[model samples]
Target: MIRVAIDAMGGDLGPRIAFQATQKILAAFADVEVRFYFDPQHFTVPEGASSNRFTSVSCSEHVASTESVDRALFKRCDATIFRALTDLAGEQVDVVVTFGNTAAMVALTRYIVGLLRPKLYPALIREMRPAPLKCLVDLGANVHCPADMLTGFALLGSAYLEARSDDAANVALLNVGVETSKGSSVIKDCYQMLSARSWPAFSGFAEGFELFDGGKNVIVCDGMVGNAVLKASEGLFAFLLSQLSQHSMDTTAVEKLVRAENRHGACLVGVKGNLVKGHGRSDEKAMVGAIEYGIDIARTNLSKKIEQKLIQQGVL
Candidate 1:
């Protein structure tokens, strides 16, 4: 059975969404076991959580979203997040899903369970455009990455897709324009480096317009630009929806594509185990999606696949 450790004390609503989602997940997935770490004073165990598959561990303390990463690791060492990570490190859990402070989660995962292949953390973001679905790496993990760092992100992203696809995924570097002369020297050098690789079917440079066009399955960019693009797209979508709301249009389709709850979570690529960071303000539906996403990662053995590919490429 797949075991998942959840930080029930994380996120804006603390343990409420986590508990609600846990109830749904437990009902839907019979083979999965869940360990919830929460502050006992704040959270009450639900009747549905009494099953053998569910385990609740009450934590004395919790970490706030605004807490500094260093403080969260040291001062709040006994926080629910740390308790969940400790369980994961001890091999008591197969995966961890949390809607906690992103920076703290990243820091703790690197310091505790360890990084497997690419030492740098890459934010794994998915594009749901039905025409052509794709994955984007380094959405907001590393703001200022060098050429080598971008190369590492590419490897991590390709390895992730490799876990799901029998055929090689077409990888591309995101640029302002399709021309190699359009980007900075770092991007140009990264282009040269990726073009020299044999595996991953490295396609040439891709533009912003091509992101939703479904032309490339994997797009690599520094966290700064990628995050900006992601937020911009979200904001643009919201603005358009607000403007068009007066027209009484069926907006569910468009909202589903760019909503925070729809994306739900981002995987911390390069980690040794499955670790998904759910949105801090996620509702029950989003948390459920995050947990299921972690389950998908565990079932696919994404970490092991990435490690093997990295070893084969002499990258580990």
Candidate 2:
């Protein structure tokens, strides 16, 4: 059975959305179990959430988005978010899902379960496009990273895609231009290193305009650039979709941006355990989507595969 620990005190809705979503998930999956952690003083289990597969644990605090990482780590260490992750670290659960403060979740998970060899922190992975599917790494995890760290991100991104398919992805660095001298020193250094590597079919560079052009399967970059690119794409798509309401423009692509799948959260790759961070304003559907994604990730055993791949590539 796959067990998932959820930080019920997370997101904007607190335990309400978490509890309701848990009920939806329990109704859909038979072999899954959930453990919800919440602030006992403010949260109560919602109706229809009572089931043998569900477990509720009371926590003393909730990590707020505005809270500093240090404060959350030291003062609110016993917060529902941390408690849920602690359960994951102890092997009591298969995965941990949260809509809590992104910084807190990342910091605590790294401090607790530790990084998966060579990773300074986890990289968030998200799917891109309608037909020729691909994954984008480091969506917003590390704003600034070194060359070698970017290399590790590439390896983690490759392993994630490899777990789902046999085809080797054509990886490319996201940059201002395809020219080698276009980006900053860090990006140029990363480009040089990736170009020298043999694995993952390094496909050179990709610009923002070429994200969905179907030339590259995986795009790699520092979190600063990657986050900007992702948010811009999401925003642009939302804008275009809103304008074409009367003309019957296909909103499938735009829907993919607004849908629960991407909004649910991004996986914190490079960690020993499965950890997903939902959007801060995640609703019931987004919460359920995150848990469902966690279940799929558990079945994939993604972290183990990532470790083995890193070791095999001598990157570990």
lDDT of 1 at 96: 93
> Over 4 Å off in model 2, which ranges?
246-263
Q: TM-score for every candidate vs. truth?
A: 0.89, 0.90
Best model per TM-score? 2
How many angstroms is residue 147 displaced in model 2 relative to the true structure, after the best TM-score fit? 1.8
Clashing pairs in 1: none
Candidate number of the best lDDT: 2
lDDT string, candidate 1, 1-316, tens digits: 8899999877787788789899899999988999989898888887656678899998888877888666437556678888888888888998899887777777788777888844455565554342344677776767778898888888888777766565467888998788767888998998899888886678878988777775587889987787778778767877899977878888888776555334557778787777888877888888998899888878776778778877787777
Candidate 1 residues lying further than 4 Å off, grouped into runs, are 46-48, 71-75, 118-122, 127-133, 252-263
Error of 2 at 211 (Å): 2.5
Tens digits of per-residue lDDT for model 2, 1-316: 8999988776887778788898889889999998989887887776665678998887878888787666537556678877888788899999998888877787888878889874445889877652455788888788779988887788888887776566577888888888887888888888888888888789788887666676687888888777778778767865878888668777777676556335346789998898887877888987888888889888777788877877787777
